[model samples]
Target: MQDVISKLVKVQELEMRATKVSASDAEVIKALRKGIPDPILAHYDRLRIRGKKGVAIIRNQVCTSCHMGVAIGTIVTLKQGKDIQLCGSCGRYLHLPPEPASETAVAMLPAKPKRKKRAAVRVPDAS
Candidate 1:
């Protein structure tokens, strides 16, 4: 699962780079494509043909490509890395980026104490 997604991402990157420069990376793209399953590669090619990204990142449980909210089940599946998940809205492959190590460490730390509110002071009224 993860392996396939990683390869797909790499292929996408290479293709993007290839488009920018005159030099071609056909060999590398060909090699990466060989690792992916035919059906998956076909779908990816189809999306590319339409001038869209084949792989999309899932951020804050939303599809970055289509800017649509993704289902919780799909997020869970992506996190589990048990299988490939696609965005229902755009039909693009969904990949949940791994949490940063600092974030995980921060989450484990105890929360800071909240500040207390000050009581209002009373003032004498002039007659």
Candidate 2:
């Protein structure tokens, strides 16, 4: 799935770069389309009809195209790049770029600060 999306994005970039879609570009697209499942290809077609990008990068846990926050669990899966994941908000395909090891380590090192307990005060009897 990831491979298909990458190829599709590359095709899109090529199309954007050239004023007209060349024969080679069409062949690349055709080959890539052949490998993608019909359902997903249909979904991609629908998204294009709606004037939305078919592939969106997951940055800061947000869909770059839709500018919507993605679910934490979905982000986790995307980070691993094991399976194809869709944005919960706009249903656009999601991709996660590799992060540096230092950044990953820093992200994992932070622990939530504990809340301080409030001191209890005895109030004078107001009876």
For all predicted structures, in order, the TM-scores are 0.74, 0.71
Worst 10 residues of 2 by lDDT: 111-120
Flag regions of model 2 displaced more than 4 Å. 15-19, 105-127
Candidate 2, residues 1-127, lDDT tens digits: the string is 5676776576556655666788988888788778888887788778877766777887776779877766666666555556778776677787776666655532343332322332235668889
What TM-score would you give candidate 1 relative to the actual structure? 0.74
What overall lDDT goes with each candidate model?
A: 0.78, 0.68
Clashes of each: 0, 0
The 10-residue segment with the lowest total lDDT in model 1: 111-120
| Regions more than 4 Å wrong, model 1 | 20-24, 101-127
List per-candidate RMSD values in Å.
Answer: 13.0, 10.2
